[model samples]
Target: MIVFTLLGFMCATVVGIIRIRDLFSVVMLTGMFSLLGAAIYVVMDAVDVAFTEAAVGAGVSTVLMLGTLALTSREEKTTGSSRAVSGGLIALVTGVILIYGTLDMPSYGDPQSPIHNHVVPRYINQSPNEVGLPNVVTSVLASYRGYDTLGETFVIFTAAIGVIAIIGRGRRRRKKPEDQTEADT
Candidate 1:
């Protein structure tokens, strides 16, 4: 119940951030949203994921956003309510559809599922010898399917570098003041 409540509040806060015409409120809501996501990850027992969420999403992201706020406008001008209504309606429909799909998913930790009886055992036994590697996943990734995974990893690294470069201090440029009085001499 607490998890659900926090999640609901988080979602509402994200919505508020999008709708409210106040810069302070938006920043606060964004922080709240990040913290709530961290909390949800904790509740789900994803400790590693929760740690990253708390650090990157809750901590670093808040600081980055606040720094951006300091660099930009503080007050947000109101754009009226019709756009809000349209956005809310679309989001509501999407959420309902996602919930319905989630309801059809198999229960977690069910060992009796077909996954246990499938071709996993064959792969587990033959993977190391067939691919000439100890770690099955590594063998599958680097030996049998190296190029595809390398491309995916390269893409992620490229994206991460792009984001970091964007946030990093750019080249310092100095512009000389215009010579106005010299022409009058």
Candidate 2:
């Protein structure tokens, strides 16, 4: 019930974002959607994912988007009807293909799931012995996929630097001419 409610809210926010021409409102709705997504992640028992979503999606991303909005128009320019129709058609087709792909996916939490049958049991049985970690999750993420995790961290750090650079450039541009002239003199 809770998951369904969160999903419904996310859907509504997405629709609102699509319909709203105001860029600020769209950003706000996107943040709300991210928060709802984080809550769903929590309910799904992915605490790490939920934390990351809340911190990055709802917090950092929202602030960065607002900073971007500060340097841009508050409303989006309207596009031609034909362009909108074509974009919508593309989105619909993509969504249909994705849904079709999911049709063959195993049901949630099936004990006999291929992953459980092969990968999970091995992790549970041998991780402590092979990886020397009592916590299976830690062993898998830190040892087995350490490079992947490091790469993800590096990407996030790089994105943060990019956002800071963009916002800093905007601030520099906003400096008064007198300030520049004074510095030059």
lDDT, candidate 1, 13-91, per-residue tens: 8779877887877877887888888888788766666787888887887887788889788887665666777888998
What is the Cα-based lDDT of residue 35 in candidate 2? Answer: 94
Clashing pairs in 2: none
TM-score of each: 0.60, 0.79
- Residue pairs with colliding backbones in model 1 are none
- Candidate 2 residue runs with Cα over 4 Å from true position: 78-82, 128-135, 157-185
Evaluated against the true structure, the overall lDDT of model 2 is: 0.88
Name the lDDT value of residue 53 in candidate 2.
Answer: 97
Per-residue lDDT over 1-185 for candidate 2, one digit per residue giving the tens place of the 0 to 100 score: 88899999998999999899999999999999999999999999878789999999899889989988997778898874668878989999999999999898899767776877877888989998999977787888998889998998999899889977976677777777769899999
Off by more than 4 A, model 1: 107-185
Instruction: Determine which window of 10 residues in candidate 1 has minimal summed lDDT.
Output: 169-178
The whole-model lDDT of each prediction reads 0.76, 0.88
In model 1, state the lDDT of residue 34: 81
